[model samples]
Target chain A: MIVAERKPFDEIKESIQDYKKVLVVGCGTCVAVCLTGGEKEVGVLSAELKLSQKAESAPAVFGEATVQRQCDFEFLDEIKDIVGEYDALLSMACGAGIQFLAERYPEIPVFPAVDTTFIGVNKDVGWYEERCRACGSCALAMTGGICPVTMCAKSLFNGPCGGTNQGSCEINKDQPCAWYMIHERLSKQGRLDNIMKICPPNDWRNQTPQTLIQPGYEERIESSK
Target chain B: MKSGSQLEKILTAGHFAFTGELGPPRGTNIEAIKKKAAPLKGMVDAVNITDNQTAVVRMSSMAASLFAIAEGLEPNYQMVCRDRNRLAMQGDILGAYAHGIRNMLCLSGDHQQFGDHPQSKGVFDIDSTQLINMVKNMRDEGTFLNGQEIDEPPKMFIGAAANPFAEPFEWRIFRLAKKIQAGADFVQTQCVFNMERMREWIKRANDMGLSEKAYILPGVTPMKSLGMARYMKAKVPGMDVPDYVIDRLKGVDKKDQADEGIKMACEQIAEFKEMKGVAGVHLMAIEWEHKVPEIAERAGMLPRPQV
Candidate 1:
């Protein structure tokens, strides 16, 4: 899932300071699961903004709205009637959803309230760890399901780069060396020979901004073209 | 002779080759390279010019190799995978060979997080193993990594780094074999402070018959002070500074610790000279380049063999 964290209160407050009315919009998907930009978070941010405005004697009004998913135009259409009532929108969603909301409401200035971190999984209630980099090519099969591109500090293909110390990465002792883990897992599976096979340099030309057509839908898009 | 480098010739002739290291100055100071090369010229077979080692910015290793050549010292040009992609690396290799650099060391350099510029991006387009294979293909097959034929490919005596002290110790020898299979003519290992582990690692390499395929030069760095010893033991990654060595330094006076460190390094080199499957000793005197001659002579590696 796309994990995000709320931006600092000061930066969020400053971005909406100029607007007299600001609507705090939240998403109910990934951000909600991570506890960063859910309906409850939006309510808390709205209350805090109102209190901060009152203390500063600023004539700013805080409003709140939550959508099922901000990335979809259908879900976004539900907020269309009330969106024009505010001078600015403070979106608490991932980067994609924030951009979608901005595109949908082109007139109102949209400010991001959260920083989209990475494609990751929730380890615990407030803890998230990055698992993938979307590098366009995946070699997890050869690596015993551990992603070296995302786990190793250097994104090494032929690795354990002399920097694997005590099963930890050279950069930090707390982080497990991705290659070490791969070695252990592969050794257990009797696939140790996989590591010895030299992997050629990755073809990174597909790493640019990519547009994907799902398997069945590819023919549909091609026929339309 | 693959590249006709002096180091390669010495090793190929079954002579115990000795190499020294020269870290280029942070600025554009050709005089520093010349100064460092002076003491090592007659004492060692070749000199390794470091490429922004530890991620600190320095004069380009290729450029420094030219200066080392100007000083009449054969340079083992070091190329790290941290800063360049395949195109730049191949271009630099061709340029270095054109400028008289015959030896090259392929390395996955220290992480940028430990360097002067921690905010910089690392470009590990190819790991050191792939780099070794790439250079080998360019030299032996006369083809680029993309399989394009080169009018004139760089014929370099390729070298790679090994760390016996790194984690998953059982895999270290296998890694060395992989490097040998990747067409490494020679290999310089990580700094060795724990002689016991190094001996076992070397014995394992010999058992696998890997030593016959490539020359193994174990690196030795003399710790200048007790603080340096402690820092290396506790801080440096993939380094194993045995407790006995630290205790030995502690047994000495504060002012005499430098000499004690040199004594330990000389002792290691002496053992490496007699050990089976040991090809040479790579003396990395670090910032204390002036002391390399003294260390080499004391270790009985003086009067370097001429091929």
Candidate 2:
């Protein structure tokens, strides 16, 4: 899942300082599931902004709303009628949701209230660990199901560097070495021989930022005929 | 002979090679490079110029290597993936080679957190292993990373840094072998303070026949004081400073500790000369460059081979 964190209150204040009336829109999907930009967070942030404005005598009136998913136009259409009531919008979702909100409401100024971190898993309550780098080409099968691109400090394809110590990375003693875990798991599965094969340099041309379009979706009418 | 680097020539000629490190100053002081290269003129084969070592900003290693070349010293120019993308790295290789730099050391540099700019982002587009392979491709195949033919590719003698003392001690030799397979012409290990551990690791390298793949040069840094020893033991990651060595330093007088450190380094160098499949010793006397001549002479590395 895409993980994000709420921006600091001071930075958020600066981002929306010019607007007197602002609507804080939260996403109910990825950010909501991660407990970052859910309905509850929108309420909490709206209240905090109100309190800060009251104490500082800042001419800012805060409002709150939550959508199922801000990226989809259908979910955003629900708020189009009421969006004109406010001067600007403070999006409490990931970067994509924030941009989508702006694109849907081109007149109102949109500010991001959260920083999108990475695609990772929630290890425990209030803790998360990154597992993928989205390098486009996945090598999990070759690496015994572990993503060295995100786990290893150097993202080396040919196993660990000389800094792997006692299963910990040389960069930090607290972090576990990605290759050590890969080696152990592969050894358990009697596939240590797989690591001996040298992986060629990563082909990064396929990883550039671009849109993915489903081929058949474009020719649906022709296909039906 | 492959790259015509002095260090490579010395190692290939069956003579024990002696290499030293030259850290460029933090500012644009070109004189510092010349001053550091003076005492190391005839006492060493090639000088390994560091690239923003330990994350601190300094003169570019490529520029410093060029300066060292002007000072009549063969430079083993160092490049780290932390600072540049593959395009910049490939371009720098050609630039360094154009300026008479034939030796190169590829490193996965220290994290930016340890350097002056902790907030700076690191660009590890390619790891050290990939960097080695890339350089090998440029040198042997005469092609850029995109498979475009070059008019005259850089003929670089590739080198890499090794840390035998880091975690999972058994995996160190395997990592070294991987580096060799990745196209490293030589291996320079981290500073060695524990003889038994280094010997055991070297024995494993020999058992695996890794010496035939690349020249192995063990790194040695002379401790200036007891405090330095303790710091390496506790603070430095991937450093193996045994308890006995620290205790030995503690046993000595404060003023004589420097001498004791030199003695210990000389002993390691002597043993490295005798160790089977060992190429030579990489003396790293940080901030104490003037004492290298004395240390090398005492270690019987004086009068460097004229390859």
Candidate 3:
């Protein structure tokens, strides 16, 4: 889930001060699950913005809307009609949604209400810790399905770093050393020998995209085309 | 267990009265906060300085309340348990009292996912009830949880919240009784829109001999528009909105809803204030602080006695 904390009203206040017409857009996916950037949050942000603007010398009220999902083109298309109506777009979506909104509506400036934190799962109602880095590599199979790219603080491919003391990371005592966890899991599986395998760094170009991967097969098969 | 002399006067006076709330600005700008508090300093008896309300992190509530007190506004430092544990909570209660913030309101805060920090873990080592008791133990006995008496125990008039409109209606009165038993000196309830249900609850409090003992102030936040009324009724947890309110909001013109909201709030306040066991009204007004005085006036709760 895309975890976020609501930006304080004053920070958001500065974002929409000069503008009279505004749109507070919420994404109803990962952010919603985490309770950050969702429809209800859009309402709250709208209310906060409304109050902040109303307090200003010349107050402004924002028009609000929520998309089913902000990252998807089809979902974003739903906002096209109302978005242009506003001078600024305050997005409650993740970074991908913010960029997608910017790309979709190049004329309208979009602002993020939430800092797009890493992808993670909710341990409970209020906690959502980050677990994935999306490093464009898959080494979990060799390491008991624990991707050191995302888990290990050092991303050590060989084995746990010396900083892993008593299963706790040196970076922060509260966090369990991810490599140690991997080692323990692998040890249980009699696959601790996998730690000795020498590994090379992953190539990064694929993640940025050489070109948009519009499915050629979806449009038309090569034989038919 | 009464903490301070100033608070002793307010509580012992029977109908416990006089409190306000201050909204911490989204940023750390002092001037920005002054503008927000410009209207609230003297007019309201006490102002609740929220600690990261809705779990949306902001300036520390304790620091802000201390600042408000410096500016001559009696600050009711609202302490939440979502971010702090028993140790920090104990420290804060004592700290607020030393700073001359005579009042404190305890709450189990909204989840952090609702706030800016979605990944931050929540420490709910104590709920609002436990926190209330912790403060009470410190205030009444001057002893820590470990049974050691401090040289000088902090003096703070403690308060807790009651959402009579939030959950199963049957549970609210029981909860209120429980909180009072836990040493809650006063109870400032969540926003009360429907007075019919509230009047009955007030009657129940009186029947249970609680009205005479505890201070129950129904919360009132003026609605800016019909959309807000409906939104709050549906969205805000533990908040109750009657069909008539929704009906009135629906019928009223968009431009005139604030007036309707004020009128509705005044009517609710007037009715609540007159009930046999009622204490007073706690007007939240959200960010519409400007409307609070008017609502208080309309609700006929103004001209508060100088206790």
Candidate 4:
């Protein structure tokens, strides 16, 4: 669930001010769940943009289209016949989908209508809040299902911070101190002593400085060649 | 404060003009009532404070408008029957006029579930058409929904919203006519975009001979950014956007998209001005009030008529 916020109209209008022919592409995946990139959203934005810029270009350029998912090659293929007609592509998908569209249709440029926020789930309709950080690691078992890395704000692994008050995080009063929740969960499960063990100031290289993984099955063939 | 009849003006001028919109809070904070009403004053001829817009509970429309008038922004008391019934609706209409709120934007309102409170019960006393007719009866005929004559009729400017870009365009046109026939003095449409479709809708209005019978104001909200455009199109009901607009959103740097949005909106408003049968443009610059003057200026719609 890649959460994203729809950019304001003025900013979106400026991006395409020069182009007469434009195609709005909607993705029906992570972006849709967060209410940013969806078919309905694509329709609304298309209408809005027209109302925003009443001027039309020669040969009558400007229209809208939606794909099942811009990230997937199959969906991109669906728009194959009509791809060349569009001068530009406005993708309502996540950053990944935008790049995929760029690669699929290199002739035309792709723009983002949403500020891809993070991976999160809809608490309910019209609401989505961040949850997981997707740190490429799973430590839910030891931490009693709470990922202290993301929830702690500071990403602390030890017990509650010295400034934690009434189980609230010192960094943000609205947030529940992740360590406190971890402590309570671990204590209830008779694993409170796990806090005594040190994991050593996590290897900075593994935690940050950027890392990438190549597919073992696919990339191995290329490397071997 | 003697105000000429908006209805009489519409009927006489053959075309009427009015700036329409509901006032949103100045900020997220809600500490004092006066702090809330400060910005809306003297900005709009009549401030329309919606009843729990977005279904998110805040201040009641009536109470907020009551406060709005107190602060000197002529309040257009939007009375939606989404949460009230025939009895309550009639009572509120009378209540609002008593409160000095003369203008109204009638709506069926977004589903309560769509708002923050999903479990909130819906009280659809009457659909927007029936509600409009009811108010018309009270205003013109001085009769309640029950056919009882009132000592004094409520004087209100009944304004309705239509979404020209609503899908299955035929239905949208048909509904707009229905609202006008039901005695809507003026209409403030859902944000207009897709100029071709709006032109088509206006053509349909011409066909229906409503090209002159009613005041049809096309709604336009300048998309402030690509992100905001996405939110409105995806989140709002009965909103439509074409692929071209979305594609236009593409190829732009995020940091610069806002400027792009403003430019696009100016062009749209200019085009809207050119279109025949379009009475006016309802600018819904949700939270982007500061940029509206620039939008109006650039669109060549600066120095808006003194409505």
> What DockQ results do all the predictions give, each relative to the true complex?
0.76, 0.52, 0.01, 0.01
- lDDT order, best first, reads 1, 2, 3, 4
User: What is candidate 4's lDDT per residue for B1-307, written digit by digit as tens?
Assistant: 1124443343345432435345545344444545545543333344457777766776678877777666766665676655776788888888888767677778767656556787876665356676777888888899997789987788787777776663334445556666777777667777765777888888888788775777777777766677777775665545666666666776588887877877877787677666767766666667665565566567665443342
Error of 4 at B192 (Å): 2.0
Off by over 4 Å in 4: A1-225, B1-20, B23-44
lDDT of each: 0.92, 0.89, 0.73, 0.68
Error of 2 at B283 (Å): 0.7
What's the CA error at residue A179 for candidate 1, in Å?
1.1
Compose the digit string of candidate 1's lDDT tens values, residues B141-190.
Answer: 99999999988989999999999888799988888888889999999999
Report residue B276 deviation for candidate 1 (angstroms). Answer: 1.5
Model 3 has an lDDT value of 0.73
Cα lDDT of model 4 by residue, A9-113, tens digit: 888878877776888888888877767778889988998887766654443255667777877999999888987887888888888888899999998987888
C-alpha TM-score for every candidate: 0.96, 0.96, 0.57, 0.53
Cα deviation of B85 in candidate 2 (Å)?
Answer: 1.2
lDDT for A136 (candidate 1): 83
What is the TM-score of model 2 when looking only at chain B?
0.98
Q: Which stretches of candidate 3 lie over 4 Å from their true place?
A: A1-225, B5-8
Error of 4 at B45 (Å): 4.0
Model 2 misplacement above 4 A: A55-59, A205-207, A220-225
* Per-residue lDDT of model 2, residues B1-307, tens digit only: 7798888889999999999999999999987778899998998999999999998999999999988988998999999988998899999999999888999999988878778998998887888888898999999999988889988999999998888887667666777887899899999999999899999999999999998789999999999999999998888877889999999999999999999999999988888989998998898999888999998888899799897
- What digit string (tens of lDDT, one per residue) describes model 1 on residues A16-41? 88899999999999999999999999
lDDT of 3 at A198: 37
CAPRI class assigned to model 2: medium
